[model samples]
Target: MSTGFIILALITIAGAIGAMNCGRLVHCALSLVASFAGLAGIYLQLNVWFVGVAQILVYVGAVAILIVVALLVTRNAESDRQNEGSKGWIAGGSVALLVFILLAGALSNTAVTGAATLAPDSSVETIGRRMMTLYVIPLEALALLLTAALLGAVVIALGGPKPGRASK
Candidate 1:
């Protein structure tokens, strides 16, 4: 409804489309960063500064960089050859239509609901405390996931066999 909301929505949609349709893997990753930044902007418009900051810091900063690094390490700068396989256009168009229908339905049925809201400072501090205390398990799991991704990247970058003639 607001100007900020309209701008953010355009940014989100454009960035998402760019990310999905970009030919270069690095360009796609950069588009993802733009999408995350737009999401953060939306959060800011909603008065959730903590969430906005966290989105920029975690997703735009760390996740985007990780994706770029992974793409580089895997040598996927160009589109994959496998993507040229048969009927890809049909499959991709079907999936896109389904997603568009779902989003349209959701938007049509949405209603604005109001509830008691916390002060941003208290909300952020509470979240931090809860994450470190009650939600420590999930945090640890996230760390483990990052560790696994790093290891996988390392393996991909280093584990390939040397090129040579095969024994007959």
Candidate 2:
């Protein structure tokens, strides 16, 4: 691997570890942005420009921002919540071990069928045209769905209007 790729991979791993271990929601969200940015850099280095930009825009820009906003909005609600200890660690570890074993077995059985090949033309223009002509509706629907989901999460976290409670 190139030195640049190695650097970006290290950054990605560091960011992911920071995000996973962080106790504060804001810190975790920022760490996720760092991870996404490194991933975007890797994608750009691979010449998949569309995916790279989408990674930055969608994950770093939108998702991270939404997470921070949610953290702020629910900060008070979460203050009173008790941390659940590693109650499910045994079950979680078992599931993770099973998944790892399954993946390892499957990968061990797979064989390389062909040499690696790069696409001749994977430019932004071609991707834009395809997105506009073929995948516009699905893409728009996805955007709407994500927005709805974010709003729902925020509302639920804020404990929006208890059932049968009269609103002012």
Candidate 3:
């Protein structure tokens, strides 16, 4: 693995850990954004420009903002600090570790990877042309939907009661 890849991986892992352990929902969402950015950087380093740009645009930009907005609009965030460290984390951690181990073993035993594959002649221009010519409608619809959802979340969050103890 390259040094840049190693750095990106460390950032990704650290962001993931932060997201999982954060006491506040907003912090978690931001950490997730960091993780997404790190992944995007890794994609860029791999020369998969389309996927890297998509990762930044779709995940880091839209999805992360949506998550933060949703968290802001939710009642759970009001009691964020109350649930800092859950007791069930140990069980969850153990299960996650088991899954990781199993996945590692399965991947090691697979013939999925060997010689590196040469990439096709993919470029930003071709991807843009395809999106504009063939997939324009779907892309526009998705943009509209995401915009509406973001607006709705902002409205809800802005109009909600101030952060305080939940009413009995």
Q: Best by lDDT, which number? A: 3
As a TM-score, model 2 comes out at: 0.72
lDDT of 2 by residue, 1-168 (tens): 699999999989899988876767678788889999999999998888888999999899988888888778778756534474675767786997999999999988999586657854778788789888999999899999989988998798778687778553
The models' CA-based lDDT, in order, is: 0.84, 0.85, 0.87
As for candidate 2, its clashing pairs are: none
Top candidate when judged by TM-score against the true structure: 2
Candidate 1 residues 19-128, lDDT tens each?
Answer: 98776777888888888999999988888888899999999998898888778778843444235544886899899899999999998898858565764464778889
lDDT score, candidate 2? 0.85
- Per-residue lDDT of 88 in model 1: 85
Using TM-score as the yardstick, the better of models 1 and 2 is 2
Show the lowest summed lDDT stretch of 10 residues, model 3.
Answer: 77-86
